[model samples]
Target: MDLGTCDDSGLETGSDAFLALRIRIETHIATIGIIGLGYVGLPLAQAIVERGYPVLGLDVDTTKVETLNRGETYIRHITAETVAAMGATGRFSATVDFDRLAECDLILICVPTPLNRYREPDLSYVEETTRAIAARLRRGQLIVLESTTYPGTTAQLMAPILEAGGLRSGSDFFLAYSPEREDPGNPQYSTAAIPKVVGGEGPEALELARLFYASIVAQAIPVSSSATAEAVKLTENIFRAVNIALVNELKVIYDAMGIDVWEVIDAAKTKPFGFMPFYPGPGLGGHCIPIDPFYLTWKAREFEINTRFIELAGEVNTRMPHWVVERLALALDQRLGRGLSRARVLLLGMAYKKNVGDLRESPSLRLMEMMEGRGAHVDYHDPYIPEVMRTREHPSLAGRRSIAWNLASIAEYDAVLIATDHDGLDYEGMVGAAKLVVDTRNVCARHGVSGANVVKA
Candidate 1:
């Protein structure tokens, strides 16, 4: 176990293709290709470039590629200066060109793997990306899938597609699965600092994957197999989803009993032992919590087993938007003497989480859609999202632009619903101005705007 006694004896002997790929990796001269210049891939590319490794980014979106190539960042948290600095290093470039995929020595897939309408695993992005790699596959190159998916995805789906180039996987080429740990808008954690989990199908693939992530992150945790690595990511997300759902349900129960859930949580969290505080909201937000747990549920069905906790959590979380609107109806009627039918509701914060513009599966959108359906006029204000687009998932609420909020604008609304508590905003002013504030986030409670003016949903 001595650090000085560590050697390369763990790496298995393989073909010339494997040996040359290993040499390039160990020498730090290998070009890194990142498919998908997204929240995950962009940070990873920046980290590699900072480490003195040249990186090429490939994406299907021409606009994103052009923006990155122009040294501008479309994401809010990432600055243009950082991107321009990386571009100036002459080691970073983003493109829509798949033909240039052959130029890189190691490739990483960081695309989205969302669930379809039936709530099944829609791995279209991973499938399409692997096929593109298959077409351009060559010897002496290593590929890694960093997309979060179900177990056996790297070996069952990607390995065969990558082997279609007349090259056997783990022999002529290396393939591995390493889950991405990118937490957007978190100032404390970055891609370069977070620990990585790496696993592979063979000994050679495992060693290469472990070493590759070791260069990027603070520590690389090597698992027994590729499927276990994938499962580890799922377990991390499912824990959050279930715990959040429990708190959301308790928020409802505590309200019914005339006890403040926020105050209860404040008291419970003070113990600081065998307890972790998970706050309630209108619903679950972000790409991981609301969607990723279902991947395990779908995969578990193959063994004729049902994931009851995941299903129950999903049901409870999904009911939050409707329950929130129902509570808003009661609060609005009690304050203004009218139902939701002509209520002018203003929603605060549209992003799934605070301070990040990512709206994937954001429950605030569902709250807006529900309010609008009930004969209420809904408008939103998010410092992050300037305008909502017509995505295939939530196209009904498209083309809505964020309205600037102030004392005058706040008084005009019949009610204000605090969806996400983005910091640095004047919460005191909004709580003081709005007549009946239905706070789904507990921002008002913390700000001391209580009594007849605010109702904690």
Candidate 2:
């Protein structure tokens, strides 16, 4: 219990304390491994290596492994230089091998926690990865679940599978849940700057997990239990989902009242306190915000309690894509003297957000599919994403093509729908050229686009 420190002489001290201290020090210096080198994992691995920890990045994608091994980054926000530097220092490496999990003392799971067609939490990736980790489970190794999930996932689902390898939690090994708070394209917060929330099964597990995150992160917030930590992540996304639904609802109301929602928001934002702005868009996109909230809602149903706000928000946000199509149809009817059918509709951007190339759950795709379904000949233009895989929803659209930025050609489209507002997009030229514009984002309004040509949603 003394936990003795190393003396200047480096000799054995009080009782068996020196031996115990040596074991602890050895474990502290053990290798760190990260699974899934996407937006969440790559930054975390880089931050861990920057903290002078030997880190291994494991991904099922061979291309990702190849890219990382060559000191390159496939992700837009992550740079090749960082990977190169880490590789040069011999502290970081990536592989597709599952067997290498045995070499890592601390393993962080950052795999995708996507929802299935039924909107049920698809935890297959987490389960398979847990099985892989359990295969290599060793005494004293620490495992942290970084993937977002329902409240009891770490304890009820992952904990048992991890313990299957003849290891007991808090005794033979440590397990914790620290959801990844990755905000891609944010200039202010890097992986190291974000305060990590960690909670383990018990006191010993919690302290060890706290120490592990504290080695790299700015701060570690230790919660009561793993379920609380999981709930914290869900609460963050659910808050956004509900607030975004509020703004989306407001956008509908303001549009009906002939009041510019963006203008109203800009005016409201002038107040310093008691107000934080959440913009209305075509719909919710990206991996986290649109999906994580539903995981909690799904779990909440088992308690026979309804999550009205969460469901309402999801309903409102989901309807926006259809509403965007309606706006486009109306814009075309007024300008071209016809319905949306055979109207050459060109979508502005395909990526979920403004600048990033991530397209998971992108509402732009849904809008395009809905437009195509309504007999509008739809084409998309995203500089970041040149080709999009055809989904079951949009099977007729074989693939997507990037729209040429030429004013003459861009003007050919009957209506241009701005789904995403990328920074480099020529908003002025687009508004000037396009005969009819449906701006789901407030890009056209911000650029002072005139009436008769532009419509805001």
Candidate 3:
């Protein structure tokens, strides 16, 4: 939690480059360029455009660019109306061109930082994006990375690549790291409502980034350096990963003891203090919790340190899909007197979380793979995700469409598994129609839609 001070007083009076950029920022005349028009970048572009700043959106995906330009939305939470409104404002437009990088006074990189096949940090997206920006690099442009990664990524990896064109970071062009905190499908926290953490290569870069973000978000928290800011993002996700892993493990132990883990959590969270409840699930999902902690674990090896605790948490979380499948198997055998082999299984909810269409690193994919590997037939139902897209990990699952939601369709399946507890789902109908229901999310209990056939996994 290296939250540096947020005062930007005398920093306004610096060299000519700094003063010019400061004036542009103060007047809201600076052109803001946002790369990666996916979950994180699109909403940020909307926020900036709403605040009277001209925004130039950049993305390599032509489909996303075309969708945004047509005033349509690919994400569920961000509506087409929002995109149309942005288009109507005449301040927002999207493109797939990297040459337009020089036109933006402040560029924010929101690219992906996924893990490699060996579970190591894969910074190819960040590296390629930096190279793209460096080729079109110019003076008076403030470059900030919003992608989540390990510490020293901005300074060690990006700064050298950016400065390879014979330009100093603090003097010729500003550089900073500000992690994007975008929680999709959460109405409580929007892009403008959340506080941003900014760390810079130098004081001037820090001040510029802090002031720029302060204009769009509720608050801009400054840290000491870019690595500190990078660590802030990792620390936030790692804390969640560890806590979620703890609960997932507890769920297994309690299930064996005939205790309801969800009920235990419900009672434990009643305490006013010293308790912050983190619910268990089939496994950790989304782009952050399941993957971000390993970035730290990989980086620690550089210092001859093993992140045993974090690694253990990851192991616990990763095994959850398998655990869930085993529970489903047992429930199927006990209730229907049939094993998973040749059984028709219906999986509810395909998105990582409830009500959102984002399918990045969803644990449901693992569940499907394991069940299918065990010779069970699987069909999924997700209101948000109509069909599975081609993912790097699960290409074979692509083009798989969700089954129709109805009692007739559900009753046809030999067993049903509730992976994500999305709101407004017909849980009562599911409990009534399905012969055997394995509840991984405790959704049936939460909805008061329990039956003898429902087993809490």
Instruction: Please report the candidate that would top TM-score against the real structure.
Output: 3
Q: Model 3: per-residue lDDT, tens digit, 54-78?
A: 9999998899999999999999999
The lowest-lDDT stretch of 10 consecutive residues in candidate 3 is 1-10
Q: What digit string (tens of lDDT, one per residue) describes model 1 on residues 169-205?
A: 8788888899998899998998889999999888778
- Select the stronger candidate by TM-score from 1 and 3: 3
lDDT of 2 by residue, 1-457 (tens): 3446543334323324223323553455668889999989999998988888889999999999999899888777787888899899999999999899988878899998998889899999999999999888877677899999999999999889988767788777778999999888787899999999999987656766787788789999999999999999999998998999999999999899999998888999999998999999999998899999889989998999898878999999889898778888887888788699888988899989988877778898788878878888888888777778665445555566776678888788898888999887778888889888888888877776676788887
lDDT of each: 0.89, 0.84, 0.92
**Residue 24 error for model 2, in Å?**
6.5
Q: What C-alpha root-mean-square deviation, in Å, does candidate 1 show against the real structure? A: 2.9
Q: Which candidate is the best by lDDT?
A: 3
Error of 3 at 141 (Å): 0.5
**Comparing candidate 1 with candidate 3, which one achieves the higher lDDT?**
3
lDDT of model 3, residue 301 = 94
Pairs in clash, predicted candidate 1: none
